[model samples]
Target: MEKDILEVERKHLSNVIKECDEKHLLEVEDKFKLTYTYDAVGMGENRIPYEDVKRLSQSKALLEYSEREQKEILNHLKAYEFVKNEAKSTKVFDEEKLKDIHEILVEGIFQGGCYRNVNINIFGAAHQPPDHIKVYDRMAKFFRNLEQFKGNPLEKATYAHASIAKIHPFVDANGRLAKLVLNYFLIKEDFLPISIPLESRETYIAKLEKFKIEKDLTPLTNFFKDLLIKRYEEVLKELDI
Candidate 1:
């Protein structure tokens, strides 16, 4: 059943791209601006208004603000921009690439990409994150495991998303960066990027927590499958399919 849905989605996406010329393809990319905003809100506590986000994304330096709300919007926009550019790459995922994406995510806010040097706690969970000192080695093990992972594209990307969050390598922005990497893998495999909506934030976090506690990936993978299906359905609807 899932395979059937995936085949339909694959054809829908192919048709959309086939239907568009160069100019319309560029417009399609622009359509993701609203997507980025929703994704940012999904990962953030202080939500930016939709209009402000649309305006903020337009200005590189023409508009500036010192407020936390504005800063969150700007930072997320930067991270999404990195995702957009990286989606164009054919590069394989690695630690260096992870750091580069983290740098883009937290630029001007803090020195990012470097693994956390201090201990931290996850709210609402008792499982202690590995010592910051072990992050490098742990991350090495992660990529090694990824190389050994034998699964479909959605499974791999979903596992990547779960593992990155579990590792919590960076000082901050782990969630956002992990999701971006998730989409990176998905897009690289020609799958539509899946954005977990803000409305599902609680369930999303709970799914991650379930993975952390049970060491079972089924729940997380299932969550991702639903999101992926929803994402494909949205695009197919836009095409009036």
Candidate 2:
């Protein structure tokens, strides 16, 4: 967290916000919501088309479909909406809040919010996540550390992302849930929400692997900082600022 880098990022972010008036903010907000939903859910093997994603995001009434593709899009849309709403609140990132977020993401994909009871290991991960039985305890330690953690919002959110992913508290949607929570806190702190694009999935996984193995957050912090900068720059371009 170099002072100079943060200062520059903040400057660009402020410009992006100031440049986007109310109408532009609304337009950018819709675009951002759709972009993030697509970026997140498009990582699956049965990826939905961009047009379908945009259409789904614009609808209010939940469309029911037996197809897995339609179901996945709706799940992500619901989860994204939940995160956006939760970001407006001033709640602490506690166990209950974490479970709520997890439930929102995994509502139809799996059992909503329960931690995994069976042991699991990531396929090619550099380090093993905590055992299922130890998941609760590890998360407790994480909450304690977060309470005392003093860092910039990006740093704290990075730590939050890494710690929760390493713990692997839930059986499914752990990564997505962690990302939403990180963005929740980031937006709560007045920083723009970051969407880790599907194109960067490998790099994101690598950074998390490094974190789990070496306890080094430098790579992930840089990753998020760059995303924030990209988001701001994109806003500027969209608004012709």
Candidate 3:
């Protein structure tokens, strides 16, 4: 029943988007980029303020933020830019593209685009990531299944997000990378990107862990679908539809 309701809402939103003029669509896109960028970065450990995110997004400098905060915010902005500009043109979803996003998000902080050579653990998570040696092979299969996945865009996007979290392909920024990959799939499929607010971090992590440990995607899929519906509602309100 809820799934049916989401399907109805999704179609209604899709139709509205189709009727939206170029300027209106651009306005919605711009708002989503700024808002989602702020939310995504805020979900991380650094927790940059919304004002700082706005300033940095516009290329304005803020002296109050530490070097790490400044770099993290800028990296998120750059990564979001990559998604906005390149998602549509991306013909294939593969390791290269995934690594590209990770690289942008960790340019100054870490070895961008490189897999971890040492094994790692997710703090407080019930699921331990695969061994470092298995990351490459697991990631290869992950990409293969992602490309061949026959589920609807929402399901596929959730899978893309959760699988990355499960595999923990990189040493850092895995959560952000997973969310970015989720948006990349959604945007490529002509869906609006969904943002998980910092407030929802606990529930989000729980749902992710459910998927990781139980291999059940229902909870995570429902979580993502609800967020997508909220995004569609926001865009519609912006358009006065």
Candidate 4:
């Protein structure tokens, strides 16, 4: 019943998108892209104001943000641009592209685009990541499984995000990387990008923990579906369609 309701909402959103003015749709999409950047960055615990993010987006001038915050926001914006462009092109999911995205995200902050050399913990989470030594082989198998995934785009994307989080491939920025990859997959599949809001931080983390601990994806998948529906409704409201 839930899946059927989501399918109905998806079809309605699709029809609305198709009927909306292209220029207006593009404008709304651009706005949502910035929102996604802000929300995604916030999720990483960089609590910069949305206005600051907007200003930074328009000009590179350093706002009141500290140097560290500025760099983080800039890199996130760059990652957003990179993912958007690649999704529109012939690019498909590959390990290299994933590394490239990570590199863009953490360019000046830390060593980017390379796997961690030491095992890590999720702080307070129930799922501990695999040993660093196993990352390569684990990620290889992950890619193989991803390639063989037979579910719809939404399911595949949820799996990708959860799997990456479980693998915890990088030393830092794992959550941000997973979210960006989620958007990448969604955009590649001709869906709008989602911004997990800062207000939903606890719930978002809880859903991820559910996946990490119980190997159940239904909670996170449903969470993402709700986000998509909200985005579609926002676009429709903005366009008065």
**Which has the greatest lDDT?**
4
Off by over 4 Å in 2: 1-6, 12-19, 59-68
Weakest 10 consecutive residues of candidate 3 by summed lDDT: 1-10
Ranking by TM-score: 4, 3, 1, 2
Clashing pairs in 2: none
TM-score of 3: 0.91
Error of 2 at 100 (Å): 0.7
Give the per-residue lDDT of model 2 (tens digit) for 147-194: 999988889989998898898888767777778878887887878888
lDDT of 4 at 198: 88
- Clash pairs, candidate 1, are none
lDDT-sorted candidate list, best first: 4, 3, 2, 1
User: Model 4 over residues 1-241: C-alpha lDDT tens digits?
Assistant: 3566556666777888778889997798778877887888887668888887888878876647787788888888889889989988996689999999999989988889999999888777888999999999999998999999998999899999999999999998888899988988898988878999889989998998899889899999999999988877776678776
In the predicted model 4, the residue pairs found to clash are none
Lowest-sum lDDT 10-residue window in model 2: 60-69
The prediction achieving the highest TM-score against the true structure is 4
Compared with the true structure, what per-residue lDDT tens digits does model 3 show for residues 1-241?
3557666766777788778898988877777777777788787677777776878878756788787778877888789889767788946877888899999999878789999888997777888999999999999899889878899988999999999989988988888899999998888887878899878889988999999999999899999988888877777788765
RMSD of each: 2.5, 2.7, 2.1, 2.0
Residue 85 shift from truth in candidate 2, angstroms: 2.8
Give me the runs in candidate 4 sitting further than 4 Å from their true place.
Answer: 1-3
Give the TM-score of each candidate.
0.88, 0.88, 0.91, 0.92
